[model samples]
Target chain A: MPQTKTQVLKIDKLSKDFGYRQVLKGVDMDLAAGELTLLLGKNGAGKSTLMKIISGLVLPSGGKISFKGQDTKKNPQNLRKSLGMISHQTMFYGDLTAEENLLFFSKLKKVSSPREKIEGALHRTGLRKFAQIPVKTFSSGMNKRLNIAKLMVMDPELLLLDEPYTGLDYDSIEFFNDYLAEFKKKGGTVLLITHQIDISFELCDKIAIMQNGVAASHMKTASYTYDDLIEEYQKR
Target chain B: MLNKILGIASIISIALVGYLVFFWAPIESSMGIVQKIMYIHVPSIWLTFLALFIAFLCSIGYLWKRAEIYDVVALCMVEIGVIFCGITLITGSIWAKPTWNTYWTWDARLTTTLILFLIFVGYLLLRKFMDYGEQQARFAAVVGIIGFLDVPLIHQSVTWWRTLHQPSTVFSTKKNVIDTPLLVMLLLSLLAFSFLLAFIASKRIELELKSRKFQKQIANLPQDHH
Candidate 1:
C-alpha cells in the first residue's frame, strides 16, 4: 500500500562533508504523497543537514535528490516552488509585523491571492491579534507560531519541519498536531524531525530512524510497536 | 613556495623603488626633499583604486556564480583597498601640513576619498558581526558592489570640482605635466605596491578558508556527547 502512494521525494546515497568530517555518509530515503514521515535520530545524526539539502538551502557534497521525479540540481525551481521549510531559526525581519512577515514570504514563494491566506495563517497560529506588532517584540513561542503561519500560505507540496515543537506551549502543540492531520488530509507530504517519539507515533504514518548518518530502518507505524522502534533505534 | 617567491620579489621591487624615489628622481624646485612623498602617496592612491575595482568585480561575480571563492577574494580586496586608502589619507595630510598650510581639509577630493574608505570599512564590520551561514556573504556582496561606485567619483573629483588637492598629473592626458623621471619612479612604486598587495591577498584568502573550515567543524559538532 505504501508503494502504491505517489512518491513525492527520493534521495539516493546523499553525502555531505564539512572539511575532514563527514556529516552525512550515504543517506537514502523516500517520502510519498500525503504521508507524514517522522524522522527519529539522536543528536548530530545529520537530520538537519538532510532537511537543509532537501529544502535546497545547502548543496550536498555527493549523491542526488529528486523532487517529483526531477533532479533537484537541474530543476531547482520545482524544489523552490514545492518545498516549505520550518526550522527553529526564524529568518524574518525583526522590525516587520507578523502579517508582514507572512506576506513577504508569500511573495518570495510566489503565492498568488495571499491576502485571505495570510489572514487564515495568522488566525491558525492564534497570532491574528498580535499581527500588527513587530516580531522583535514577540515572545519566543509567539515567533515559533508565526513560523507555522508563514508556511501555511506557502501552498507547498512537501513540508520539512525541524523541531517545530521545541518552544511551543501545550496548547500550541495540540494545535500543531491537528494542523498536521489536516495538512495530510489535503494530500501534503511531510518529513518531520522531532524527538517526541511517543506523540509522533500517533501522528506519523511511518517512522524512519537515522543512525550513523543514514536511514537505518523504515517501519509502518501500524505494524510496529514502541519496543520494536526502541530496539531498532538502539541498534546504532 | 609561490607565496615565498612573491614575498622575495616584492621586497626587491620595493627596495628598487626606494632607491629611485630617494636618489634618482629630481627634487621639485619648491617642495624640495618633501616632494619624495608624492612617489609613495600617488602610487598608494593608484593601488587603492585598483584594489577596490577588483573587489567590485569579484562581488558581482559572487552574486552571479554563488561561489565562496569570489566572496573570499572580494573581502580580501576590500581590506587591501582600505589599507591603501588609509595610507593615502595619512601621507596626504602630512604633505598638506607643509604645502597646503594645514593637516586636514574638507575639499572635494579628500571628502570623497574619505567616504570611499568609510564605506568599505563598514563592509568589513558587517562581516565581522553578522552571519549565520551564507547570508553574510550575500549581504557583503551587495554592499561591496554599491560601495565601489564611490571609487570612480573619487577619481574624477578633482576635475568635477574646485578642490584643494592637486589635479591628477600622472594620469593626465597633457604632455610633460610631470618630469619624465618622476613619472617613471611613480610607476615603479605602483608595481612594487601591487606585488605586496597580491601577496597579502593570497595569504589572507588561504587563512580565511581555513577559518571557515574550523567554523564548519564547530557547527557540525554533536549537540551532546552522550
Candidate 2:
C-alpha cells in the first residue's frame, strides 16, 4: 500500500541564542504524521533547546515553527494541546501518589473523564499496585513509567522527549520500546532525543543528527545502518 | 528610557524635599523636632499603598492572562511594597516611642500593615524555596491577591476603631487639618517616592527576567560529551 504521509510539524531556520552563545543557529526539519523521528546530538548541539522550543517551554530567538499548518506563536494554546513533553525533570509533586499525580496533571491538561483515563494509564504502565504510593518513593525507572503514563493521559498527537533513555535499566528500556512500538502502530508521532543508538535505529522511522545547533543530516533508518548513524553522530 | 527619567526626577525631587522640609516647613509646638520625621514617614506609607496596589493589579493580570511578564511585574512590585512597608513600620514606631511612650502597640493600622508585610515576605520565601516555572508563578499570584486584603483593612483601621494613630489627613475632608506649607511639602515628597517606585520597579523587573534566563542558560550549558 502506497500512501503519502502528512507533514505535521515544520521547522525552518530555527535559532536560539543564550546571551552571547548561539545555541541553535539555523536548523530546518520536517516531521511527518505517524512517524517516529530520533534526534541524535552530542552534549552541546542544542538538541534539548530545540525540543524545548517545540514544546513551548523556551522561546526561540529567531525562525518559525509550524504545527498542523498553523504558526506556533500565533496558536500556542492549540500547539500545547497537541503535544506533550517528557524531560529529565520529574515535573510532578513528589508528595502526591501516582494516582494523585495523574489526577492533578489531568486537570491541568483539561482532559475529559480524568479518573478513568488515569486508571487506565496506571494499569497500562504497570504502576497500578503503587498508585497510592507517593512518587518520591518510586525509583528512577518508575518515574520514567509515570512520565509515559502522563503522555498516555495527555493523549496528544505529538510527543517531545529529551534524553528519555539516559538512566533507564534493561527492563525499563524494554518496556519503553514496546510502548513506543504500540504507540507508533496507533499512528502517534514522536520526536525523541536519545543516545541509545541500537534501540533507536530499530524504533525510529527517520534519524536526524544535530551538530553545532543545526540538523546536520537526516536520513531514513532503512537507508542507513547502526554504524553509519554512530559515525554521523561522532563526526558531527 | 522612562525609567531613567523617573530615576532622575526622583533624585531631584527628593533633594528639593530635603531642603524644604528642614528649612521651610513649620515647626510644631507640641511634637517639635521629632515631628519632622512625618515628612518621610507619611510619604513612605503612601508609596507603600501605591506599590502594593500595583502588585495586586499585576497579580490579577497574571492569573487571568497567564502571562510571564505579569508574573515578573507582580514579583517586583511586591518586593518594592515590602521595603516601603518596612520603612513605614520603623518610622511609625520611632515617632510613636516619644509620643505614645511605647515602641510597639497593637493598634489596628500598625498591626494590619505588619501583617501585610509578613505576608509578602512569606511570598518571597515561597518563591525562593519552590521550583521555578508556571506552578510557582501561579502560587505567587494567588498569594499576592489574597494578601492584598489587608491593604483596605489598613486604610480603614483608624476609622473603624479608636486608636493612638492619627486619622487620615491627606485624604480627609476636615479643614485646616494641616498647614499649607506642610501639606505642599508632603505632596511633593509623595511625588518623589512615586518616581522612585517607578525607577526601582523597572530595574527589578529587568533584572528578574534576565536572571531567570541566565539561570536556565547556566543549567543547560554544554559539557564535553562525544
Residue B138 in candidate 1, Cα distance off native in Å: 2.7
lDDT of 1 at A185: 86
Specify the highest-TM-score model's number. Answer: 1
Worst 10 residues of 2 chain A by lDDT: A216-225
Residue-level lDDT tens digits of model 2 in A1-236? 32578888999899886644678889898887888898987777789889999988787878999998999988999888878788988877899999999998789888999999889988988899999999999988789889989988988888898878766788878888888887787777889898777877888877888877878335464556788877766775
Computed on alpha carbons, the lDDT of every model, listed in order, comes to 0.83, 0.83
Q: Candidate 2, residue B223: CA error in Å?
A: 7.6
Tell me the fnat of candidate 2: 0.00
Q: Write the per-residue lDDT of candidate 2 for residues B1-226, one digit (tens) a residue.
A: 8878988998998898888888888886666788788888888888887888888898999878877799899889888989999999999899888867789876666777787888999999998988776667888998898888766766676447644455544224323466787788889888888888888998899899999778767755775653
Candidate 2, residue B155: Cα displacement in angstroms equals 5.7
**Measured with DockQ on alpha carbons, how good is candidate 2?**
0.06
Residue pairs with colliding backbones in model 1 are none
lDDT of 1: 0.83
